[model samples]
Target: MPAPVPTPAPVPRQRDTSPAEGGPGTGSLYGQASLTLLVIEDDPAGGLTVPEILDVDGHRIRLRSARNLTEATRLLTPDVNCVLLDLALPHGATGSGSGSGSSDPVDPLAALRQVLRIAPRHAVLVLTSEEDAERAAEAVRVGAQDFLFRDELDGRLLSRAIRYAVERKRADIAQYKLAESKLRAQENARLERGLLPHPLLEGSDLRFAARYRPGRSRALLGGDFYDTVRTPDGTVHAMIGDVCGHGPDEAALGVELRIAWRALTLAGLCGDDLLATLQEVLEVERPNEEIFATLCTVDIAPDGRRAGLCLAGHPAPLISRPGRPARLLPYEDSGPALGLLPRARWPRRQVELGGSWSLMLYTDGLIEGRIGKGKERLGQDGMVEMINRHLDSGLSGEGLLEASVTEARRLNGGELTDDVAVVLLSRSEA
Candidate 1:
């Protein structure tokens, strides 16, 4: 008998399978569904005469060969996904067809760096001898996706390594993005704390408004800062400080000192004693010898009739009573800025705030603004006139501050390059 005719079973429908969905990773590894490789070798014999590579789907691969990095660079394209670079470059690896030893010992890592610059998003595999594993590892750090020992590698192993390396590189890019986002959040938080402080006035019938803008563009906070607190005598204590530099560290130190000031003021620390303790804090936290801070403090009387002012190498507070024009308190008797003069003594001078007065405390970033088109700054007198003009404009609260800053920027014809911080304390006699 000729054998029974075989009956065919019902055919099963095939499911759609894109190369990217065939495995792990972003699917990009298998998207091309190909094993195109640029094999760089300066060896006289060319590539491993018997070329072999396991593809993305567990299949063998035939490599396209290049004698040097120059040819390899020329061959690099979107379709050529991976590179197999040989560390033992022979003569003329510089695209001259000479070889590795033909001239200078061609550094494979240097070649790898060039490859990365050209093909930043491509995956690469570096081939090295067992004794050169260290150099191979370094190649990975320099942008190669993976490094392998030439002796132990096989077709299947090479394919798996390529897939893993590609996946890892993509993961690295994602992690970097996440880290960048987190850093931005941290910076904003520090800025919020440094620029805005918790108000200490509750029952006091005083109007307090403050505005702060860092010299650093797109920055939330800077070393220039201010704060206020109500002391035990029902006196409102206000202060403004400026660190020498503009950086996150300086802003952080300023915040620390501001918070410490509030705490000490509430605890009855004032004048030289308070400044001395703050200097100690600066001494401990400042990053280096060049780091320092300038400060000014004011303690208003309970009746709003008098105020004790202290200056520490910082611009003095500008005072404007109802009948008088704005003017800076005093600076001739001021001590050196904190961190500049050890055990510095800030003199406590009595100033008449009188009834219904407005006191403006600020960092040098304010007075140091430009004057007209000249390189000359606003200085102490210029700032007083500017404030007087704003006060006469009937702008108050945040509006007053915004107007002042706008004028400064307008005078400068751009944003203030240095950090600017200001606090306004206006009181009515009891």
Candidate 2:
């Protein structure tokens, strides 16, 4: 005895309509006025003609038929919105690629799966007999949008299923992309924090504060780097450097150089020997011979009253003491930048640091910004004047560095087109 087909849940008349097709008289600009369905069934001659199913807005749904997966592939066009695959279609007996005979009984959804593979982007609905209702539901679980029992299939029901499937697929794709974007953002942040150096000035009396800004858009790290550490002998070593470009590659090189500097310094290297070893590191790690880096390194004495200064074509450090205006350190005897000369000799000079003084070390990004829209740059002399003004206003330490960098960006009329890094070390006798 044949069992009666279970009636499907009622489908609403005014389903969400999109402008993917034309509706009744003329499709709305914002809403699809029509829909196109591709029906893949084994018997083309079988009386399976779709009845007239008009959308709520009077837009009519169009239908196309194919006897097998091969023919359906040829008719599948960009305009086809949904696919209706008949699950009863015959498959090859030997599990062959021809898909000629009845389907494999072990996997009754073989024919439906073939249709899905060919039209993966299109929404799909499986059509089966009422007796195979369980298999039809399984087809939906295998990625079909819905399933229809042959005995209860109606024009209105099919129309509603098509619209629902398409909308559901779009929502799924949007959700996937949003999640992917957030994951990428989190990974970049972790990578950046790991790459950027943290000050190693433990047990030192000098107050240290630093700031960095990348010139590249949407980037957290740049080609500017700095570090400070106190050696076993109580000599505080601080350095700031800049690579020659503005990109991730250059930023990566900057991090490498900063790390190498710390390793060598902690291992007891300083002055010309330290500078020479750093040049070797830059040469081996740089992407090309044309790549180079400017650096300024200072080793403060144990008493914090004197220091050894070495410059590799980098800007000089600024020093300001009580009862005197801020001034630029002597820079006339600096050596060529790293990776420039085969046997570059960076001469280290000794400078006296009076009691209660602040010293500023930075990269070219600090003083290279234009004074205004004009071509004139805020040269070393100009930077000296600017720092004197800030000192006159009673700003010191972090407040001083923040104000100076902000003023530089303002003078350039916008963000500087190069990476900026600033490090301030201040000693107080009071």
Candidate 3:
């Protein structure tokens, strides 16, 4: 009689690794939770035998088996961390292809592609015989984390490969998100640069320099806006304004007001008439009734020796002469800010801008910064003194503006918390 065949050892039952039961395994790859493996193969005769696997911390890895794509779909849950797919499985009766637009019945990797599409977030590993090394490599290129040969797979190797594949998938996702964020930031910078004004001072004798800083963190534009343009008649028009808030919506409103001011000024509207129409725009376009905007307008004559000044609840422009200290132009007749008073009137005052002089117009952000740790602010008087000091040191033009803004930030102890916009127009008798 033939010797009796030794009885095969029964497979061990998988333990529950749910979070409720003190959570999953603390394996090397798994940060906190244990790992689960879903094996997809149509092997009724048990051709493929998976050995009992353990994580790095010696915790047993739970296993689930699926006979076909239909059964695999039902078992693909959020708790399933990794998938082990057999490459030799049939494509089933439906003959579904990779979501790559066409279906091919003869394609051996069709089932693997289907598994990838259905379980995109989970890590996947393909199993093939040792002879099919080319196909295994192709599977990895097609999106699988890795591939293993059935004859070479052991408990230790499978456990390590599963952990590596999961970590790699996570790294890939993080890299993708970082690239996406950088692209979005680049697009936003381009848009903000386009929105900034391009001073139209062609055929003008004056030299113009400006500096703008937004208070909002990581923002390129804010509620402060300014524009300078030389009209058809040789008179150069310059205006600067600030909306009540420093948000995106306020920035948009400032842009609209700047464009509208440019159009109205080119059309010959000045002083009260232009400000009245702008108030109308603010009332209609503002998100609420409480929004308001302060403005300052200056129109330099063709001779560059005189200018018309208007103030709508705005700071007075500082004027500096060849041998004199900088001082603010008269602002006693200033009117209410736009959207604050219905039918408000802004008065135009004729000021003699002597030959060879510089005029600096700015929003309130520059002067409102705290002087030190105390509550006292760098008011208009302090800013005038600062400008005089810079001028005494021979700083002028762009260098002067740069030094001024830099000093303001330094005095505030850090970055200024409000948007600051400064425009400097200068002329020297030649």
Candidate 4:
């Protein structure tokens, strides 16, 4: 049907002011658009088969009329948020595109898709002849928020259905976002546990203090891991390692490596042999070859002051003597990171500490923190300086680890954007 001859200077209708959508005022006047609506129909006369309806805020709607999909597309605007589309039209017909004038009859579903295309951002209500639940469901599935039958649709009922359709769409969107958040958290937790362990300190007198913080903000963990275990001989062995990447696969591989390290250490493996076997585990567990782990291991002697130190593609340990500044342990004979060099030899370096000295093992996360916004990183030397300042205040064990993490974050001026795992071992005159 041709559009009614345009009323030259037709008064732009006042928008419906209903209590529901919070328009200009309460719907005291007729023709107010509190529930401003547009009806797309085939009839030339402006009439709605809908009997009774209410908008979201319990306001009657001021209905606008559009004959067929052609006028409907032109009238679609933000002011008319809800659309009541007639589903009797034929297929593949919207008003736009070449040869899409009144001559081409449009399919109902295709017309819905086109009307949705035209008013892509609006909520839609589909109207069918009979109460066909299946067809109504399809309309809702095809993006119409609700469906109404021409026979049962009254002013009150139509109003309620339209309001419900708008609310349902908002609820669906919220639920999707919440589910996405939960899935992300679950994945992060799995990776984090692999990178940090509760430490097996059953038979040793040494106190173990460690802290791990992932570099990825809002992420559970990255690829850094640490473990501590005591041998039957009363010796305490501790290590901190970091794989090359910050992904879940790298983290899972890191967890496997740590577990293997603990088992081998309990079975009398140490230094090169333990690391060598770990490379085999890596080859089997890693998703690809590009991933590798840097490690720092320290074995405190039965008496505690003496220790065997090994660095495998990792930073050297830091030693802080009682009443003296802390400094890096010797890195004279360090090897490349595990999983990189098949024949790598991580030679053990033995060091003696006077009673009351402290040994700290940490991943590169601590030393690699950026000093400022620039590329300046707080390298090992900078870390040593920062530690000395913290030690001057006489902190130890968990207290010591907390102070170190705080200082690292403070120096970075925010949370360190890398996974940090630090383990500290101290011996007092016993």
**Root-mean-square deviation of each candidate, in angstroms?**
14.5, 6.6, 5.2, 9.4
Score every model by TM-score.
Answer: 0.60, 0.76, 0.82, 0.65
Ranking by lDDT: 3, 2, 1, 4
TM-score of 3: 0.82
TM-score of 1: 0.60
Candidate 1 CA-lDDT value: 0.74
- How many clashing pairs does model 2 include? 11
Between prediction 3 and prediction 4, the one with superior TM-score is 3
**lDDT values for all models:** 0.74, 0.81, 0.84, 0.74
Q: Residue 287 CA error for candidate 3 (Å)?
A: 2.1
lDDT (tens digit, per residue) of candidate 4 on 185-211: 887678655556878887666677888
Best by lDDT: 3
TM-score of 2: 0.76
lDDT by residue (201-278, candidate 3, tens digit) is 999999999999999998879999999999999999999999999898999999999999999999999889999999
lDDT of 4 at 424: 89
Error of 1 at 30 (Å): 23
Q: Write candidate 2's Cα lDDT for 294-392 as tens digits.
A: 999999998999999999999899999999988888988899999999889999999999789999998888889999879999988998999999999
lDDT score of residue 24 within candidate 4: 19
Ranking by TM-score: 3, 2, 4, 1
Which stretches of candidate 2 lie above 4 Å from their native place? 1-162, 370-394
